[model samples]
Target chain A: AQSVTQPDARVTVSEGASLQLRCKYSYSGTPYLFWYVQYPRQGLQLLLKYYSGDPVVQGVNGFEAEFSKSNSSFHLRKASVHWSDSAVYFCVLSAQGTGSKLSFGKGAKLTVSP
Target chain B: GPKVLQIPSHQIIDMGQMVTLNCDPVSNHLYFYWYKQILGQQMEFLVNFYNGKVMEKSKLFKDQFSVERPDGSYFTLKIQPTALEDSAVYFCASSPWDWGDTQYFGPGTRLLVL
Candidate 1:
């Protein structure tokens, strides 16, 4: 079965510091990966996605993710963090040809402090 | 910009009572999905709907759970005889095309069963 794993449950970083949220997926075949962010009491918002080409994909709020097929990893990164960027980040995966059902990681809680 | 909306941001119900969570997908979206996230847990896929039928459902989608997109209006998730374990945040999302497309999620409906 396809699964997603987010190694960190909580990560604290200073404002204006660089950020990286780790994600790894387990799948039998080609995988479609996505990164989503959730604020308190808000819905999940898409940050970035990796389907086929370009190992690096850019997303909203100055976020980007690099997809590595060999390592089955799609790690999210931000050049600088803001206090407003503190939120829960989820890594999601879907099989190449399946429907819209996604298997999501347990999420990493990011705290950007001043 | 298109968005999804979920009705009844929060609800408290007695165990064994039936509850219906409502969602309105984007106007031009062709695929709809439901996901559940228990407090402090990752969001998990419940089901996906398209073309007036269910395209996929995860094992967590019990028999008591049903989804409908009647008249192309609200997409609803009805849980019959809700259990205590049913307490979670249910999110509705829609994609303009299919699974590979970026999904827009609604503010989730938090359901608590007592």
Candidate 2:
């Protein structure tokens, strides 16, 4: 069984500051990792995905995540954040043969202060 | 960009009543999925459907819960004898193919059982 762990439950960053949301997964083979963001009362939106290409994958809204097989981590990072970026972010992982079933982490709430 | 849509953005029902959540996937997508997210918790995979059959399901998919894509028009999840525990956001997602392509999600249906 595959599982994901998001270490931080909540993170606060000021506008224009760099931000990082940590994510780690436990899977037997190469994992398909994804980052999703959810504004309040809205559905989850795909931020970025990491498969078997470059270690660093860029996503919408200037977000990016780097996959590290050695660390079993795919952490999302942003050079700067805005108040509009405040939302709940989730780290997800899927195994090679799982089809469309993604194992998601207990999301991290990001609060961007103006 | 392709988008999925859900009906009855919010539904409130009695504890013992039945509830059906509907989803309309992208026009050409072949795989459909259902996921649940309780308040302040991680999103959990429920079931995955393809070619008129369920491809995979998680432990969270109880016998009381069922999924169908009748007529290939809408993918639906039905919960019978709904309990308070079943009150959560039910999300429907679809992907073009099964190989880890981006799965677009609908603006989930929030169910409240009282």
Residue-level lDDT of model 1, residues A75-109, one tens digit each, is 99999999999999999997877877788999999
Show where candidate 2 strays beyond 4 Å: none
Residue B85 miss distance in model 2 (angstroms): 1.7
Please tell me the TM-score of chain B in candidate 1 relative to the true structure's chain B: 0.97
Please give the TM-score that candidate 1 achieves against the real structure: 0.96
TM-score of each model, in listed order: 0.96, 0.96
Candidate 1, A34: how far from true, in Å?
Answer: 0.8
Poorest 10 consecutive residues of model 1 chain A by lDDT?
A94-103
* lDDT (10s digit) by residue, model 2, range A10-113: 99999999999999999989988999998886778899998888999999989999999999999999999999999999998878987767889999999999
Residue A69 of candidate 2: its Cα lDDT? Answer: 93
